[model samples]
Target chain A: MTPSREQKLWMYEKMLVSRRFEEAIETIYLEGKKPVFNMAKGPIPGEMHLSNGQEPCAVGVCAHLEPSDVVTATHRPHHQAIAKGIDLKRMAAEIFGKATGLSGGRGGHMHLFDPAVNFACSGIIAQGMGPAVGAALSRKMQGKPGVAIAYIGEGAVNQGAFHEALNLAAVWKLPVVFVVEDNAWGISVSKAASTAVPENHVRAEAYGMPGHLVRDNDPYEIFATAGKAIAAARNGEGPSLIEIETMRLAGHFMGDAETYRPKGEKDGLTLRDPISRMRARLIADGDADEATLDRIEEAAQAEVDEAIAFARNSPDPDPADALTSVFV
Target chain B: MTNTNPARANERKLTIARAMAEATAQQMRLDPTVFVMGEDIGEFGGIYGNTRGLIAEFGAERVRDTPISETAFIGAAVGAAQDGMRPIVELMFVDFFGVCFDAIYNLMAKNTYFAGGSFRVPMVLMTSTGGGYSDGGQHSQCVYGTFAHLPGMKVVAPSNAYDAKGLMTAAIRDDNPVVFMYHKGLQGMGWLGTVPGATNHVPEESYTVEIGKAAIARPGKDVTIVSLGIGVHQALEAAKRVAEHGIDAEVVDLRSLVPLDRETIRASVAKTGRLIVVDEDYHSYGVSGEVIASVVEHDLSVLKAAPVRIAYPDVPIPFARVMEQFCLPNADKIVAAIETMLGRQTVGEPS
Candidate 1:
């Protein structure tokens, strides 16, 4: 029911990597586009959807997941993809549009398809729902010891596909967990304008499923909630929806001006950053010292730097081969 | 085209990306109602440098970054335009039009017609197009034909910086919904790498290059080559190589596709009596087909020889660079096609 100190530390390490990797991406995604901002003028062109402040939801939920367990994520998929244990270097290369990338540079940022770890994501809204539901169904039919997690954003709750997937998972009692990373704002439109309900977890009641809400971007609460939900799903009880009040620290996309954000909201978020809070919590609880945490942070930085370097040095796929993988 | 004159300092060169942003900035300054909206148009400057630096001047309210809700924001631009505001909305990639087709095809394109000339929808839907650096099918597409084919929407695709600024100004001032598609390869973006000479000497002052007219990019006498966007650059390269062989190939950049610059095509084809239509879109039901049709419908006698089409094969764009390049229209392919057409070389034999 509770994580050991080593297990908590492991979660910290994963969380640290997610944050450091995204920070690297933020810097690299802006490579030559600055002083004269051009999105198409960077190593990572196209849309860059970052999940900077939403690390806890991924690390907490994925700590209990295995390589065999299926995980489907949304457009803002960096944190979850990293936590799901997909190849970090390959992911960076994928974002770089290189030959050595996970999808051979085919999918780019939003369409990272790493099937080795049963991890994949899509760019469209609520696109991962059916795949998550289907993956869980196949596992159940084969009597396999695995579950599927459909990770979506608060904005995706309004999409009809999300509701349909949730109902299907619940009615069929599939081993799937619907995780909503509720970051409050969706592009420029707020949750208040988009959704009818105040909270996303409450909507799970409509599908005859149990709902759990975790607040404050707290990993402790998120881990507790996700543990029980996954335990139940793995035990063949049913599906549960876990909504975490995550933070979207950056703009909707990398270049977003964020004028729609309330004044002082970004500053407030910076102060309440989940990483600093967790570092403080770990020290206060006697789980880890500042020196140890610093070492972990340093190790994470090294790993991220190596991954980025690999992506930067990797050769681009031959333009003639773009037609190859369409079939097999 | 480079203006080689010391006194013409105002004609300093600019990229399609800078020219487009400059035009939007100028229009926004003149007209209070002229605003911009898209996924990353604000501080992040648009995905293709189309709205760069506007947010710092006009502030976020005017140079807004709407949520990724394309269906809502694109339709909102139409609604705002109908209500007396000029909104320049960008749909990130032209390939993303499927998710929000109603707002674009129905409301933005046909709203004024449906209202029976009640009100005008003076809006600009600027988007990125082209396939060269392997962004896969979604990010890399020159589907301006689809926009041009949809009756009410005026399709404007500019190849150089001069026309990029001119047509953007015209699109802003026009009282009809205009779809401005700028190819990524001609944007002078350093990341994807661009064709040399894509930048041109664009004048500082705002000017409108008349819509429905084509510009003679290069002059020749033996054959006429018509193309736009990245294809125009490829055509120019092909023209220079053929000139060495004494086979003249005139290049006509059909800047606006919707207005269908038939007059220019007819005039050019009439002069040379040989035609070649080059397009980055699919081979079927595309600009190439329409250009060839315009020539044939006018007079069957205009053709001294059978016309040729250099275009992407009918298939979804591939993500692998090798496959994409094979599908793309390039200078070598154009040269080979010309060589075969002129009987100087045989088919399937490299010149």
Candidate 2:
């Protein structure tokens, strides 16, 4: 199904917002890298996995989801969290390790959980799949209308939990959509070197589920595929798989040399930048003018800037409070 | 004998397995959100029969028989719990935890704390533990100590049919993730021989035995015998054997390992002035050592004699019955340990 002009614009804006939010995180992370020698001594402490060029997957898939729908994301989850409508201010505070953070400064960047939007991320590979399956099972048992989306990286497909979860979800006919974001690399290891199959969605057939592959950074294609899969799941037609092929424009983590890639492989990365391509397409298709596109970028930047300000002003969690929150 | 109140005539005798099933059924009836999922739990009524007759009552939807995917089902239980469902997922055997340890220790145990108190994994991971029938190293292990060593999980190993029902009820109602471990030998299954009082009189109605409380099984004034699960029965037998020698042993059943009832243990040790921790788990850095340390850490003056431990030696449980019995903590071992601690003649060549 072709997206309407308004839908295209909304997708464009969301992609832009995700990109800008990640960009802000990168800048803030760099600021903390003052004495380049020691990376640990920083305001945004701990490793930060930025979803720089993978914004289209989040924007496209989340655009079809309601706030009630549950989403489980991977380590690099800023883009998906933003697209899923997790409060940016609290998320920023969480990354900054402030008391006003989503997890009260306990969970850093790797473990962001916004229960308001039913979103959670895990640092472990393929770990989110089980939880997403559980959430889907819960929705099905409760006769709820919500479906769960589990976002995993291509590298995670090789994990046992991934296959186990898919099989369980299929056997149970749970309302869950497994979205595999094929960014081509798991940290330094390329997908070709890691995964046995050339494509990820094809493996979904092993579990007796319909699988679709969306090539390139096309948000429209993702939206179309995700919409159908999500609808099928919500209607109790069981789970489906959608694999979106994308690129990682940035290093695996902040300050990652990315020496594993060939020289100049990242030089032309911007050529396939999803945000830029969507912006250009929106303007060319007459869905949005250049001025409106520019306005969206500015608004996204403003929102990110406000989130940063809120995080900076937030208080650090007291040392004594560490004993709290261990239980209910 | 301590109290004059008459026992309720309605109290029915139940095996640990039946009591557990009744507790689960009662909880599932009380709360629509509560459900059971495990391997062969639906039509087969669980390998240990802890979930017998649940599928017939709750239907296949609630009493689900999951595929042999511990990581997936356990992780899914965590996810379901986070989404406001109280799931009771079984691991089939605690020994199989090695395959899905990450899901239990990492996500289920630490998620609530990691989420900064915003999320609660109100799930119960009920797994069968212990081995007396030569299940071997792979199938037999009371790994409650390993689970209790972790920070975020509440560990409960009920000794009798009564505590099994109460503890299972409490575990289901609890907001935190609970590891409800039931010994296969204590389930009172006809196929698997039960201990002396494994099939005790349990109340018909639903109730919760407080999670972090210890029950004095056989109160006395001499050495305090601290144990749990199958070890409780062994300790009681040892106490009776030693009572002929005028040794008044107080058997303390530590129902919950995490949030441990250290207060009761300390009080018992303070009164008895001697302690002997009998554990089926390994000897080094385990429950027995923890119990000894609790008394030492709190008040060293309470001990008139050095505390002792009767536990499995630091070795894998062998498959041979003779070897397994030698490695296992039994009444003979407990009695020997007590006799040795009291400077008396050791029995049965110091097992």
> Could you report the DockQ of all the candidates, in the order they appear?
0.01, 0.86
- Candidate 1, overall lDDT? 0.84
| Residue-level lDDT tens digits of model 1 in A120-170 | 676667766755765665566447788889899999998856776777677
Span of 10 residues, lowest total lDDT, candidate 1 chain A: A319-328
Per-residue alpha-carbon lDDT of candidate 2 for residues B157-238, written as tens digits (9 for 90 to 100): 9888888899999999999999999998898888989995778788888988889898888889989999999999899888
TM-score against native, each model:
0.53, 0.97
What's the lDDT of the predicted structure labeled candidate 2?
A: 0.90
* C-alpha RMSD by candidate, in order: 22.5, 2.1
TM-score, cand. 1: 0.53
| Per-residue lDDT of B193 in model 2 | 91
Q: What's the CA error at residue B302 for candidate 2, in Å?
A: 1.2
List of chain A TM-scores, every candidate: 0.99, 0.98
Q: Candidate 2 has what TM-score? A: 0.97
Please write out the lDDT profile of model 1 over residues B1-351, one tens digit for every residue: 222212244568888899999999999889987888779999989878889999999997788776566765665566456545788989888899888776688557654543324446788999888888889998888887788887778888988888899999999998888899889889987786877667888888988887777888888888899999989988988888877777889999999997888988998999999898899998998889999999999987978899999998999999998999999998888888888778795224224
